[model samples]
Target: MRSIKFNIIVLLTILSLTTFAQTKVVSNSYSFGIILKIEKFAGRDFRYSLELKSTDTDSLKNIVIKVQQVINDDEWLDVNLAKDVTKDTVWHSLKISSKINPRAKEIWLYANFEGNGNFFVDNLKFEIKTESGDWEKFPIKNADFENNENNPLKDFRTNANIPDGSTIGLRNRTDSIGGKALLIKTTKASVIFKTNYGANKRIGKYCNINGIKIYYETYGTGEPLLLLHGNGQSIVDFNKQIPELARYYRVIAVDTRAQGKSIDNDSSKLSYDIFASDMKALLDSLNLKKVNVLGWSDGGNTGLIMAIKYPDYVGKLVVMGANLNPTENAVEKSMLNQLKKDLKKLQQKQDTESKQMTRLLLMLSTEPNINVEDLHTISAKTLVLAGEKDVIKAEHTRLIASNISGSQLIIFKKQTHMVPNENPLLFNETVLNFLKQEDVKN
Candidate 1:
């Protein structure tokens, strides 16, 4: 009986050694790949036990195993034995260990031949040896099968309790919050243009004003000119004319509220007033007493509001493709309705918040006040620009120029609403000529 007991102990020791072997090889090409599906777990360490057999010892050293989480397809983890492993016999066992994050739902394992060798595997096993405890719990409690619905949390004092209200509209907010690094000032640098010198530089550190953080870039040196962009575009939209405009004047371009790298706010409360206020805050933050303003599309309307409500902050104004009345175009009304419908679908889908914000901007952009008479009260030196093909007829642009005392009108012959982007050279030439005239008068 003692002899039999000793033999059993020896067999157990051999089994333990066989179980810990690290290399696995397959025999037939058809049976080469192995699929491992890990069970769903909030937090756990996944352990896999693999059995390997190689008909040719030369094949063991060339074995490779690929491991990856199933949900995100782009990333992969590779596991390899420390040394070459060749199997002369059948059913050699190996153990592999990996830790899965709390959020992981499933994982996969595949075995492949690194070279021409072949082998097979059986008696595969997987288990969770440990669990992660510090990981944050899912927001919803009792969210199990059949009842797995959740709602976003909101602060009533700031944002509305609506799930959509809590979302900030932006993608790549972390990376693009200040525009791409490529577009910003890296260090103190200056470029010399034909007539003037331009310096591409950042003006100030990021600051939160009225619950929004604003960033601005400045170019050239002369009378301050504040350039505002339309919806869905950042300050980068001025890249084409930055160098040229900077050559003549101190050109400052800004990423408006909830767009580009600017901080997002409650979408439900966002209106043109909020954007105008944000621009005012930026100017105040910069300590600029007054500036010449140039705005395109939504930016143009924003400039008009600034000139109307805070006339002291603006010296001269140039507005392009600006609508003085919101109800002038039926097409715009139809577009807004379509946008509202699309927004509802987006809310239902709970898609990216930035996409929703983009839709909202589109709706607000076309709702400009159409009454050109409003410009008559603006005291700043004014330039009304319209693309020959602008949705606002050339006659309407002339009407705007006529209303504002001493305001000049320029029409780009073949241009449309997108003059700055599509006809940078012509737009810059026209703007420079007007600014030069203003300089001569001053």
Candidate 2:
């Protein structure tokens, strides 16, 4: 009887401990979506992301962040928030992502640190992704919960009755380095997002280019004007000039393979030469013997390759922000570093969209190393364009012009790499004037 009593007690104790451990707070997360406040933010979708530094108060800390989407009033669908997670007790930066519903009027967020002890999370920030795929830190606007502007929730909402002995709200705390840290302390949390719809107006068609479905848009009638967008861009990059250009010419704006609406099928690693070849093949598929090509950024670099290697197919060319060497003036070092970090973050995702992004980011950070002498061989009438504030250095842009025989160089005053978007009126006029200029027939 004594032995049996001791065994039963041991079994009960084990069960109690197991249950306690499983119930401990570990996985952390937040919600962001469908907050209808201002008119500007209404009827849009967004890619919401979070980045924050965390310190564990206990060695048994296991951290994970997840996303949940609202299905109805009482039930929510489980969404994967962590692209990749590594359990650690040390200081680490957490990255989590989720998307917002354009149609839903409301949404919620939840998070927890599921382990044996508490961990202080700080430097917490929620970001909404831009059309360029860059994340912008969200600032508080319309602190009102409803029509009432004085509601206590500055930028979020949470329930006070949740059991787990965990607290979820903003708190003041000191960091390990003796600095003031304001943390959005949460065993669970929620936030908001407003989408920008500038890039969604145009729908495009995809045609096979070297066995890959390349997305493109065409309009108007005259000579074929093949407009190529920059790195990480779509047909929308030329939104400012498309309509005007279409009025004068048959504008063929193409989204390079694996970018925008285009899908990729090539098994080999992508390169500028590959894109150039694809553009040449696209022209062939459309039954055009020659066409005028206008390229921006990476597109410009690809144009240089096309004019050099497939000289006969390109009648006239305009290359903007093209660089012969990436190390020299391709982009700022800080921008390159950010690309590397973004590539690392996307690597953890199992989705094809994420993998395609990794490929494009990889292409931007490395690869393109053009020889200036190659420019001398291009047979087409060429225009080399750049912005004064372009990411590519001034001298490098001039170098490209010097090498290309009789090429015209024009630098837009006070403009940057995104001249097409920032100074659309000027960009359209300049490109149109150059395209309409009569040079001796090629």
Candidate 3:
């Protein structure tokens, strides 16, 4: 009986060690690439291998694996792997090995396609070198594309834009090796693919504040400009604004506590006040005295609080879709009702993470009891922005603008709260114009 049990344990361990774990990439546009979120794999020697097939009858020169590491603020170490691929529908075993920079602030691993074709990938394996020099397998969930989820490509993230006349999408199909494979199909349209904006490792770092680790990234140089994203969002939400803003000022994009890469350890409730305090501590850690702040939604609420309570830390302030209170008078009834329903569902889950999310929803439903008159106390140069059809009532937005002395207001006509992302060019220009204009002399 004991021998049988031991054999069973050994078999289970062997099966675990042999499981295939890898990512999939598909290209239907001019370029397609998969960015591996491999922070834990950094500073280690690793190998990635996969079975690949293509329908294109040309040489496979367009397919390559790229390893990029940041050497400094302006330099990088970029290497291409798997150089001997050929055009074939048969299974080709492709593998690459490299060392990740131990001191790099950012690193990227990409499986890229730079042509038009139907590409299939399956049975991918990722391995890391152990201390004793043997390779150990690292398991990626749904790596085999056999998961019975609604979306077979649930774990993969694609580029946001698919150009006109381009047919870029994912499908699960029978493959030669495994029973199923991920097919990336693209045609006609030319689209350029690059690294994810906020997912860059070279510029991301952590700071200890309020007993939690806060994640942030820095770009460009000049007067400090701080960026804050909405609830359940990270620095990625500011992707449209960062590059342009970086050209003029030092951009500090942060992932708020309990969101993005930031981790919260305390069980205390979350509030705009706490978020504002976290920003203060983060600024102190960076030795920043004052900064320009751009915030959206929940971020906007936090920025308003910071201006009210810690005015000394604010140089100029811009907030979109912020509300003084969590009431129907301030927020739209439909949105508020939906949030309450979500809070109820979260409360029923009763798990640790769910409870934390419940707290977030609870805060949104009943907190931020700011007096409209408090806007009068903010001392920083302020710009209040919102969409004409914003979730926040038009009257509430105007009330906020009217209470703040010398503050400017702009409501984008026929737009929604997502104007920043929907019309980034216009949003960026409007923000820059406001930030750059000289103050009027009395």
Each candidate: RMSD: 22.6, 20.2, 14.8
Worst 10 residues of 3 by lDDT: 14-23
Question: Positional deviation of 238 in candidate 3, in angstroms?
Answer: 1.2
| Model 3, span 390-431: residue lDDT tens | 898888888988998989999999878877776788899988
Point to the candidate with the largest TM-score.
3
lDDT of each prediction vs. the true structure?
Answer: 0.55, 0.62, 0.72
The C-alpha local distance difference test score for the whole of candidate 2 amounts to 0.62
**Clash counts for all predictions:** 13, 11, 5
Question: Considering TM-score, where higher is better, how would the candidates rank from best to worst?
Answer: 3, 2, 1
- Candidate 3 residue pairs in backbone clash: 28-186, 105-201, 105-202, 106-201, 106-202
lDDT score of model 3? 0.72
lDDT of 2 by residue, 1-442 (tens): 1122222222222121222113222233222222222223333334433334454433333344444444333223434554315545344566655555443333333333433334444444445666776766555443212222233234543322233444434333444544322233334321212111112334356678656898777778999998888877777667667878888998888888788778785545778998988888888878885688899999999989889999878888998888876774656676567667777877788787767777887888786888988888987889999999888888889999998898999988898787776667888888888889987855
How do the candidates rank by lDDT, highest first?
A: 3, 2, 1
Error of 1 at 342 (Å): 5.0
Query: Which 10 successive residues of model 1 have the least lDDT summed?
Result: 180-189
- lDDT by residue (tens digit), candidate 1, 160-260: 11121112111111222221110000111122122111112324235588667776777779888888887666676676777788888888788777776
Off by over 4 Å in 2: 1-204
